[model samples]
Target: MLALLPLVILAATPIVLLLTISTERRHALTAGLALTGLVGALLALPTAAAQAPRDVTVLLRVDASGLAYAALAIVAAACLVVIGYRYVGAREANPEEYYVLLLIATAGIVAMAFSTHFVSFYLGLEILSVSLYGLMAYFRRDRWGTEAGMKYLVLASASAAFLLFGMALIYAELGTMTFAGLVAASPEQMSNAVVLLGLAMLCASIGFKLSIVPFHYWTPDIYDGAPASVVAFASTAGKLGVFAVIVRYFLLPVGAVTSGLTTYLVVTAVASMLVGNLLALLQTNLKRLLAYSSIAHMGYIAVAFLAHGPVAAETVTFYVLGYTLASIAVFGVIAVLSTEPGRTSDLDHIADYKGLLRTRPVLGAVLIAGLLSFAGIPLTAGFLGKVYVVLAGAQDGHWFVLLALALSSVAGAWYYLRVVVAVCSTPDGESALERPSVPAAPTAVLAVLAVAVLILGTYPAPVLAVIESLHR
Candidate 1:
């Protein structure tokens, strides 16, 4: 119960601040709330890391996997505070509601990390999804933002319906909603038709969250319409929550049915990799490019889930850490650089970035580093992350999976390199767009993220060790 305090605090902070703070001081209130949440999470770190697994209830538990995910969400939220400092302050819209929604969203993420039952999972997911509807359309003056929000709302609600229906079916068949209880019940207890149909629906719901192919229509539009800071939050933090739940649901009590699901996941992952990267080549907008890239990256991480072993867990965690850092660094830069009054993201066009090195060398360098990491260039964290996934898949005799991943990597290099080319290329003096001014906090955030990415790329041993330690 004590170990769960951090989650409680995280969930409470936003609501508390929203009620207590006056509108005039909302900015400070928001930052203070986030800071409180961060401190609470940090204080719980040692407990979460050292304590044994404990069941809070039949439907929820505290364990190492949840701890890892909670920590990631906390860190990502802290980064959001820094990156959003100026954006929140400068905007003319109501800052109070914006920050309140952000805190609620963060709380929802933490809840998702700790959920152990289908009911709790659905509750956490809806909390996150509902908050995101507001966050996506925070800039209501913009038609694109409102349109994106509406689309996300419709798609997300439909997915939720599918998920709930699946859960009802599973409960009907197994007579339990708790993960442990479900695993304890033999497959023979349920009708094969019900099990298959429920699992397929479950997959569809999660696929929508993960932005996998056939269910990824909302990603590009939402990413392109939201502010860069919000996009960053959605891409990394939101996906991490979904991945945490997926890993827990798939990896528990390892069995034949889980194995079959893993096979399906592998096939979907391969398709996402090829389709996401190839589609990215046609996008001129940076947000859309990264949106597709995110789908591809999810596919890369999905390969680890297909492997199903201690190595798979470690691989997924390491890959997620590297990918999240790269995303934060890239999006942080975009938040700062794209502060134009009306734009959602600065990496709007390759042409817009020509000669960026001359005016914003630090941002250019960070962008280049991030791009290289995404491309899995040697000696980068991305390289090690990719290697782990490929090795894990190959160990399990997933040959076609390995081949598709390799070819996708090669194809991915084209668009990633195109960004690099634009960054390095010199443009005519008059044609060069003047580098926009960025404030101190966002710049500091980018600097920290850049350094983190570089350090992780060069010396990934410590992070890998932490991931490997979760095998127990």
Candidate 2:
């Protein structure tokens, strides 16, 4: 029962918020309730993991990996909710309901993190997709928001079709919906043409959710259209949840039985790295730049995915945590910069950041630190992440992908440094932008994220030990 606690708490959060909707302090009350629910979920993690590898149901598996990713998803969601308080409160007529949607989305995320069966995975994916559709279009008055939402809906529905067809094909061939059943099959059964095709389709659909290249067309537009806080949740919590399932699937015994699948992953990883970074260099918009960078980062994680060894899971976990911290920090700055209601976000133009160091030094420093981490500079969490990726690639002797990763990071550094330079540049005149009054809560959250990055980069042994223990 303790193993079920996190999911129970997450599922109940929206209802708890809905019940308090009539309260006079509804906005503050809603945020507080949502945060409390996330804290409760985090608190339940140790108990959940202590009884390691428990099957909660046919659909859910409570295990170390699930527990770890659940913690990451919930933490990322909590950070976004904190940052979104001002953004949602100002423009939303029914502001309290926004927390309801967020918590509900997080519930889907948690489900995906713990899912062990195809049925559970599809349900969780649809739940997350549906919730995000509403959150993206929350600011319906904006044309960009409306258009982004529609585009995502159409593409996401098509992706779901691919996934379902793939699942159907696999079931027809193997007559199994569970990973254990599939892995138990003989290698000859696993290598059927239909099964391979089905696996390809599944990979494609998952690739779309992770925003890797070729399936990543919707990312920049969606990121640009959505609120910064929501983007933070989508990039970190949403992607990490999907990756959790992939991690489990790859760790299965049958994973090594498919050479064709391994080759397909390698090609896609290289394509994502090259394309994602090249496209990012041409972007002047900060949101779009980060969106493209995320694609490359996903590809980098793929290297670890392809490496079969004891450390593969830990490497992915470390890289993801580093990326999560950097993304949260970057989007936190964007949320703070976006103070106006019923207007475009303030993070759109590169020029907007000029003289930011002089006007908002704290945010300026945070933004630079976050960007540096993203660029894989030493003394930041991202550098450690890249080192692990390199180790994984070398372990697998994947020289081509390793070279691609190196070149992509160089490309990434160029664009990231451009932003840092702009931030330090002098304003042409008295900066026309009004410095938005900084909220203590969001500011404090950003500070914590920045400090976490530094600490993780400086001394990763503690967290690495924990990840090794969990996956061991």
Would you estimate the TM-scores of all the predictions? Answer: 0.94, 0.97
- What lDDT does candidate 1 reach at residue 92? 37
**Candidate 1 lDDT (Cα, 0 to 1):** 0.79
What is the C-alpha local distance difference test score of each model?
Answer: 0.79, 0.84
228, model 2: CA deviation in Å? 1.1
Candidate 1: tens digits of C-alpha lDDT, residues 330-366: 8887777666655443446667777776678878887
Q: What would you estimate as the lDDT of candidate 2? A: 0.84
Clashing pairs in model 1?
A: 381-457
RMSD in Å for all candidates = 2.0, 1.5
Candidate 1 residue spans exceeding 4 A from truth: 48-51, 256-259, 341-347, 427-436
Model 1: how far residue 207 lies from native, Å: 0.1
Q: Which pairs clash in model 2? A: none
